[model samples]
Target: MDRLAGTSGFGGVYGAGIARPQRGSSIVIGYESALAFWRRSRVEDPALTRELLAQLYPDDMLATLDAEALAADTSLRPLELPNSPFERIHHAALALGLREPVDIVVGKDAARRRSPSARCHVWSGPVSDGLLVGVEPGVYICSPELIVAQLASELGLYKTISLAMELCGSYSLLVNGACEYGVPSSTSHSRISSVLRLSDSFRGIDVAKQAALYSIDGSASPRETVLAVMLSLPRRLGGWGCGKPLLNAEIMLSAAAARECSRSSLRADLLFDEADLDVEYQGREWHTKPEDRTSDEARQNALMMMGKSCLFISREQISDEARMDGIALLIRSRLGLRPYRRPLSTGMSLRRHQMMLDFGLA
Candidate 1:
């Protein structure tokens, strides 16, 4: 996406813009520093990183990053940043309140000693391509997609899938692997690296591809992410293997239902459109409120009027493996799919159990 040249963002940071910087300068926030940034900032879905930085940092802190990183040219060229990956990561660490030794990505050619600086960890790799997302005129962070690909190298497939789900969904994942349902996803579909967009050029692309296979967008809460993964992922991987549902899908109500519900349309948490069903996730935190419960009932009635039966999945129900499996069976039956022949053995238990563990459900 082309960034607006002069628009201002939260805390006086231009939400999208790049200042000209000298070529061959390479200061980019990455790895552990990137993790810290992603965790601390709960940016709105359609947002830029500078908004977060601007709130936490002074304007001048980004001024150096904005300088000498580009050349004056009417035309653009292959992107490169200034050559100080360490300085970049250090600043990002400070900005994100990271206390651990900074992790910086250096070119493969950069020298490494048997023992390098104790204060920072060095990763040998070049920061090139479109992997680096510009946060401001000069500052950059690993793009959300790049971060996923980088992390996939070290994480298991379940964890990788969990991370991909959060990224694809409309919510953010916390450092502790908890979903911050209140925090909207920072990366938009156009900006996030998606399953279909996984490229061979990236490291761990194969793993990322696998992880993103069943991930769908528009999940507004953590439970929805888990629910979708549980239902949609292949049975071989311990998912119920029901058809993946469209998450947070907006459905316009018929004239009668709309007037009855007092709304033109409603978004279902997990929409089984083909089955004419709406699976709603009721979070313990808010849905218990009397007013919210009343509203949910009304929404369900309105949906039913359109021939879509509504199935409610409570936060409590999601926590129980037996209950969730039962729910999945019910959904598959409603969708007219054959029963999933669940296997009992062959090492499926741990892998199946790990999905819950990774998602903090277990």
Candidate 2:
């Protein structure tokens, strides 16, 4: 698994456990299911992905096809059990005592009826070169990039960027899929795709490519992602134009600072390295006890001693335009950048206001 993670060539399919296609393999999971697989993978076992991949792709396929060529070949993939992928999955779920809707993807030309069972969402399309990742022999899921690309048409710009952040963010959506009489289930999975793998010319990735350009890595939560996007985007689109900061970047502390703060290092929610400043997004997740405040003060004192400025922003301040602007002013002052004096255009003001409320903090 370490070797698998270490390899740069395999991409997210390997993370989801792509296997070589065999005689009766079916392409089962895709779309929301594929997205769900990635979010679930962060907590699930890499072994699951691995085993599924092994099941999908027969090892013997490599004997004739080179590794690269084998990965590129999607022709060996089979239809979903002679006819209906949706019904096939529904029956399997019933056997397993599960009841969630199953999403199935098929090639653009694959034969599918008008509909399937009540619990299926069918998507037919021409998948990109690296889209399908086999987990069980012939079974596949859309890659993370492909999933985002699929979503781009629906998500627009800001939402697409937010999706990118969430996909690569610290917290997983964490679905507990266990259901039924006595079937045992647990949570787990792996990281198989990233924004870096986004393609410019991919069929459905036109908007996602732009989102990827603004997307940064290592966001801890949705709030942090909102802050990053809000502060990093250009002013014309309702942002402070603070430029992208390092989200959840670790900063090693000096012995003196560590001694005072009682820690050797600190992980800032957002860090502007050039300005020697750190912005902390103190959302509802943080405990508000007196001791927590005391500890936070100590850390702040440590940063002050180190000659680094730290600004704390809460959800309340984030929602208030005046308060957020004050914070931005303070940040720009510290960054040695000029603040905007001219008022935003009416359209820009509306866009900015909408952006603040757009992110689903809940």
lDDT (CA) per prediction: 0.60, 0.60
Q: Per-residue lDDT for 186 in model 1?
A: 43
Evaluated at residue 106, the lDDT of candidate 1 is 42
**What TM-score would candidate 2 get against the native?**
0.75
Which ten contiguous residues of candidate 1 have the minimum total lDDT?
Answer: 67-76
Write down the TM-score of every candidate. Answer: 0.73, 0.75
lDDT of 1 by residue, 1-362 (tens): 22223322223542333333334564445665676567556543335344443222122322222212211221113333344445554555566566546444443433322212113224322233233555544555665555666677677677776666676565675556665665545443333333225245545667766776655767777678788888887777777778789888899999999987899999888899999888988777765489887888888889889988888888788778799889988988998998856554666667778787877788
Please report how far candidate 2 places residue 42 from its true position, in Å: 2.1
